[model samples]
Target: MSGPIHPPLCRVDQIMEVMQAAFDPAWGEAWNRRQIEDSLAMPNVFVLLVDSSGDLVNADAGASGLAAGFVLARHAPGEEELLLIAVRPEFRRRGIGEALIRQLAQDARARGAERIFLEMRENNPASSLYHKVGFEPIGRRKAYYLFADGTRMDAITFGLSI
Candidate 1:
């Protein structure tokens, strides 16, 4: 007897596909395949991918469709960290990023997380989205990020209580 086919809960290919199109190379913000694979290997880490329709891509649907956006997060007791989130450049301003964050928040809350935290380089365009989603700047580290051209930027930390 043959067993039923089950799709992977997270697809790295789809994540990479979106990442390549979403992140600017100059920022060096995109994670490599090995980083993503290693993160996903951890028990407390989870990835959520969304399709063009802003629907969750899971085992039951859109298993092979390219992801429009993805969010990766790690959970700790009573808290979760938004490690990375990206949407294809063409998909920006279409609510996909918001959808991903909302879904991640929902999932994090479901996993017993009471708050979420994330850090971004200064002047990141995503600041608006973070603010719109109720994430408040809680702290900052000056010259936290060093670019290839020897430029440095502060890293702002934001937090959201679920």
Candidate 2:
């Protein structure tokens, strides 16, 4: 972690590894490998972050600059949706999430997008990070996220003008 973490563009499997570390099975928020493969197959969809720092690396991990945190997004005619964004458990609060958010905004702007939107569980603590990056709460869906433990959380939608 010497320099600024500029998550390199990576393949689906590489990104999925990061997703695995970033999400817990109980949360029901992590996307599976096949889902990511299917997503990458679609047009106008792409990944925009991979933590190459090796800060969370172990002897068994490969040298693909594995994802510490990453953003999966889709761009349409004039807007984009941040489908998912996550930072590995050990990598959280180290500026990786913030950097990814900043980069996603730049990427959207590059596509001539008017703005970017994202939705997350209302109980997600990262809401502060979203707000700090200039995202405004635009809407909410009641009990949008259901967990295996029988609890449901509202989905808070946020928007950031590009």
Best-fitting candidate, measured by TM-score?
A: 1
Model 2 lDDT, residue 10, Cα: 39
Error of 1 at 46 (Å): 0.7
Clash pairs, candidate 2, are: none
Give Cα distance to truth, residue 71, candidate 1, Å.
0.5
Q: Count the backbone clashes (under 3 Å) in each candidate.
A: 0, 0
Model 1 steric clash pairs: none
Count residue pairs with overlapping backbones in model 2.
0
Candidate 1 residue lDDT tens string, 1-162: 011112245788888999989999999999999998888888888887877888777745438877798888988999999999999988889998998888888888888999999999989999999999999999999999999999999999999999
Off by over 4 Å in 1: 1-8, 60-62
Task: List the lowest-lDDT window of 10 residues for candidate 2.
Answer: 1-10
What is the C-alpha lDDT profile of model 2 across 8-65, one tens digit per residue? 3335666787788877777788888878877777777867655545343322334355
CA lDDT, every prediction? 0.85, 0.75
TM agreement with the true structure for every prediction? 0.92, 0.83
